[model samples]
Target: MPAQQKKIIFCIAGVLSFACALGTAAAIGTQLWVKGTILCKTGALLVNATGQELEKFIGKIQYGLLYGERVRQCGLGGRPFQFSFFPDLLKIIPASIHVSVILFCTVLIIFALVGAGFFMFNAFGSPYETLHGPVGLYLWNFIACSCGCLIMILFSSEVKIHHLSEKIANFKEGSFIFKTHSEQFANSFWIILVCSLVQFLNTLLIRFAGFEFPFSKSKDSGTVTGAADLMY
Candidate 1:
């Protein structure tokens, strides 16, 4: 292909890939934010549990609620009553959605990065040979799969939390809840914000880099129709 045509293709690919990367970064950041909020509230409650019997009971209840469970058994039999703690699926679903978003964003970012790398090489590489724009597409796909796996793990984690909470809440009825994860409470918002910034930077990089065929190489067909030459 002509130099002009190659350059045009490069430009288009670069723009699209960069956009994908930025989008992914933003997604991860958002996930961190949502998780962080929940963590903060949980952690604060855990830290400030100081009081007499009543205060202790309140603390337990608070923790229990966070994981969507109520206390069922405490002090060994106290008449052995049963209690149930179930999270409103409505709330859990939203949490899961937030997680999904993060994964989606990561996938996009990987795609962009991979594409950029491939294209960058292509534009500078050789001439007369065709190079698939970006194999980075696979990178995103892999990341997405990993995200899905994480989501499944998270689902189990949430279930465990619910069961544990229920057991605790029943022990004394609204007396224990789980503390939020530390990273979520302390670093999520900042992490996500930074991610967004990274995305913006990626965008700028793609725009400025301007796409070009990285692998444009001159044809040496005339040298020989030999198998060795073809392989090379």
Candidate 2:
């Protein structure tokens, strides 16, 4: 690629990295990770509710990493309640797994910002060919992508294997028991998936700018050294 074309590619990658950072930050703050409905098992069983009547015993629940809002339906009416994960939910949910997901999110954001800065540096400023150049770009993007994948995996396990939503619904409720009727990952969760893909796409863009994928050069060099040895 021409120097001017490389510069354009670098600039585009930088912009993408920055956008991923902003999107991740926004996702962490918003209460839109999981969306589901909780069935009031106690109430439904008591009333022996069937079909259409069961709707009265079902409530809606949604949450993010930090805090969330849920509408409790126990056959009487929907009762709105707000909650936080810091201290309130520590006793109920899988605190370790939840905390791990959050830690990875933080890691993803930090790496994304660093990657953006480095991309800009490589584009405009003269950088060291080893650390601050192509190698650095590959390293940052790979780490960010890994972090994003870990975040999603950990969170999914916490929700599915540990029964996160049902536990949250049952917390502090002695008389009424709740069960997760239906659940789906919401917009915020999908955003992280998209951000991870963007990081991957940046790697291809780097290749489009004429940079080799990291480590391939070393293997190629070794092959040439073995060929020379055979001749001797």
Candidate 3:
């Protein structure tokens, strides 16, 4: 292959990577938005559940993340406490799992790219050498990152409503129980969107190494790629 062709192939890989990144971001953003709505709605339902004066305060709690903060403000030994979506480090498990899968995929991609690149370089020993193998690898890595983003988003949506309700009850009782909730669409939406964007950007950087979009297929030919293979 010509020297120009090798560069072109790499560029194509970059574009594919970028596309994957975008998909990942979209998923995360949606998850965050859903979470916000869920929490706010839940709080409202509880506030009206008992017909107590505290019902009016549901909005207040939703607005400021006040319920959880109040628990942290609990004065005693001045112990610093924090609220998290999941218990201790366990909360991160789902996201962590997703991340882990992405990382593993990234490693495999790197290996494949290097092997392919090296093979092409040695085989053609010219501009064609550049076309080699790394392009496909980069393409796959982008896909993996995107997949991770999706997993995290789906997990977020599955958040247990009952758990949040109990937390609200604690706050209403004036007990300093640290609560983590999903409600208040504004905040939740933005957070999830931001998370998604970050993941997307990260994936883009890793996959594309910064390039324009609409990648053209490789000249190598013969091989089908699908979303299912990229993600799972």
Worst 10 residues of 3 by lDDT: 64-73
Question: Candidate 2, overall lDDT?
Answer: 0.92
Compose the digit string of candidate 3's lDDT tens values, residues 14-34. 444444444334433332332
Clashing residue pairs found in predicted model 3: 3-127, 39-182, 39-183, 40-183, 40-184, 116-133, 117-133
Off by over 4 Å in 2: 218-232
In terms of TM-score, the best-performing candidate is 2
Write down the lDDT of every candidate, Cα atoms only: 0.38, 0.92, 0.37
| Higher-ranked by lDDT: 1 or 2 | 2
lDDT of 3 at 198: 41
Report per-prediction Cα RMSD to one decimal: 13.1, 4.5, 10.9
Show where candidate 3 strays beyond 4 Å. Answer: 1-56, 59-81, 84-135, 142-146, 160-232
User: lDDT (0-100) at residue 47 of candidate 2?
Assistant: 85
Question: What TM-score would every model get versus the actual structure?
Answer: 0.31, 0.94, 0.33
Candidate 1 lDDT, 94-197, residue by residue in tens = 35543554454455466557665555455565423222422232333234334434533443355345442333332332433434222122233343334444
Consecutive 10-residue window with the lowest summed lDDT within model 2: 223-232
Over 118-214, each residue of candidate 2 has an lDDT whose tens digit, in order, gives 9999889988556687888999999999999999999999999999999999878989999999999999999999999999999999889988887
User: What is candidate 1's local distance difference test score?
Assistant: 0.38
